[model samples]
Target: MNTLTVYKLGRVEYEDGLTLMQRFAEARKQELIGDSLLLLEHSPVLTLGRGAKRENVLASDELLASEGVDLYQTNRGGDVTYHGPGQVVGYPIFLLPKERQDVRRYVRDVERCVIDSLAEYGLHAGIIPKWPGVWLGQEGAPDTRKIAAIGIHISRWLTTHGFALNVNTHLPHFNLIVPCGIREAGVTSMKRELGHLVSVPDVEDTLARHFCSVFESERRESGVSVRTVSITVLRGHGPEARVLMVRRIPERGGFWQTITGRVEPGESPEQTAARELKEETGLDVPVRALDYRHAFALGEILPPMLVEETAFVAWCPEGHEVRLSAEHDAHEWVSPNTALERLEYRGLREGVKRAVALRGELTGG
Candidate 1:
């Protein structure tokens, strides 16, 4: 048995993540490294597997860019799937021992690790007869929600491109594509079902521990990681109402988007929203926090990390003129759909939709 060294690399960009796992996998095959478990997060990216269909991806490049999502192709054994912040991705570099070279058994054991780990939180998860991965609900129900996804690529008995478990993952992001090219079952997350935030670190550690037990190995952890925070401000009411959107300066990824800004240390997302609204739009109005939270991965800047962003809605007093901040060069008041057209993530879009849908009730109009 070998020590299952685990590294908690916060949020690696998809390409970098792939390269990292590949390096470890190669080392394992050459007997230069012990069995290893790489646990981390990836910024929003859709990966296509062998036989993956093009139509599986419903969002165009412009749409994905507006949402800050990326797409890639991989050799993993599945269709198209997504990964992002608030999700824990595990890549195991384990060389099959003489007595345990069965691929089917290996997949089952990997699934069992997830099943047992989820049970720690009182969740009952299991495998579908043919669908693979961990799921809830009746065995034959095609529409059951899947909380975890597994797609591995094995070479010379070594494995990579492992599992993705939705911890506090934004399930709406799955709407960007037909997950694993499956229109049958739906997608879900631990936070969505539990109705609370599950510490993502706890989920990662639990997964490492379970994989060690399942693979008959000990554990070693590397670098500690933390999460980033941000906020979004959507203005106006529903279908007919217009929401305020701002265009960032070229240096800040110049794009038309909702008023967005990062949360400073010791600041709550609500506070960040208000501050961003005032700073980006000069809107001194109090913002009503929407019941919306979504996360995505960003590695473009140094020390890539995952960010959890919350949305807020503000109603300006009539006659408020445009005041542009240095961060944004231009601003516009557009319909909800127009605002969302330049936005990605399903959760954030849905938040906008819900805010507009409840406008009548929210304002008693």
Candidate 2:
């Protein structure tokens, strides 16, 4: 029987958790690790997703600091949200199987998981097709309140950034931010609905069960086998610091990553990779001319349907001016020294190091 890689934790450090999750998804896709789950909690903090409006967060920096809460702009969907001691943040980095990889469907499925889990506690939940989360009670019920939030980004059909369910939330902390930017609609919690705090293990178990059911049905229907890509580091160059990396969008959040895309039907992997680079970043360099191929997986913390990814490298440096497509938001010409420090994926970093090392060897630098 196929199984998921499950990780459990209490409080993950705020600064690194989001990046780690992004890397995990990328590594899984690049390396092909099977379904994986990263179960963890966040410190008292506020996070703003891609569409989040900064003005929605009403508190001043001094005020937030006084309350021991930190604000962060994230790559996920939705508006401002608060994470505290009791919320169980489940990042399910799963490949979207061939049969069930639709982004909209994946979002609905996550809402279903949360709704099903809530049902176990005698709470009825529903989804507002116009809104992207699970809500308490049935549609049109006065009790409706968002119970969970979903947002994601996919590279090569692999996913990253996932759902956050308010298990035993600290409601007061939420007051500072406009949850999902919806001032009229309130955010609900398991504690609020159940009148008691729910255990993280219990919630985790429920989520696992729902996910297994969702994927099992998918696997039976479509035969895409999933795998988690393991992370490997290759040493090269000076300062032990110089590295090259490729990261999925939004997790590198505000930074620009080299163009990346999935293989299309009848498309060669190299062709797809080269095309995506041009489409996403607008650097029209030929794939044959640049660097070397470094392959890895963006693991299963994603849509739970996508499978397989192989990445290769080709550099377009300072001499070039890029014409980026709308798929990407920005671009930059970063040096290998800076690239090593700034780029996100472990495998991509290693690939950069290898490229730099080879360039020096060929030039006798």
> On residues 1-365, what C-alpha lDDT tens digit does candidate 1 reach at each position?
56888877766667767766766666677677788787888878999988689899999999988887889999998889999989999888788887888888888988999999999998898888768688987666765889999998887787888899999887788999998877888988899778899999899889888998988887886553332223344444444577677788999878776666777778887787788778777788777766655444454422223355566767776678868899888888778768789765454565665566556577664
Candidate 2: where are CA atoms >4 Å away? 138-142, 217-365
* lDDT values, one for every candidate: 0.76, 0.64
Kindly report which residue stretches of model 1 are placed more than 4 angstroms away from their true locations once superposed.
224-365
lDDT for residue 138 in candidate 1, whole number 0-100:
62
Question: For this target, which candidate reaches the highest TM-score against the unseen true structure?
Answer: 1
Writing each residue's lDDT as its tens digit, candidate 2 over 114-186 gives 7888889888878887677777755566656888877766666677777888899888887888877866577
Q: What is the lDDT of candidate 2?
A: 0.64
Please, what is the TM-score per model?
A: 0.62, 0.58
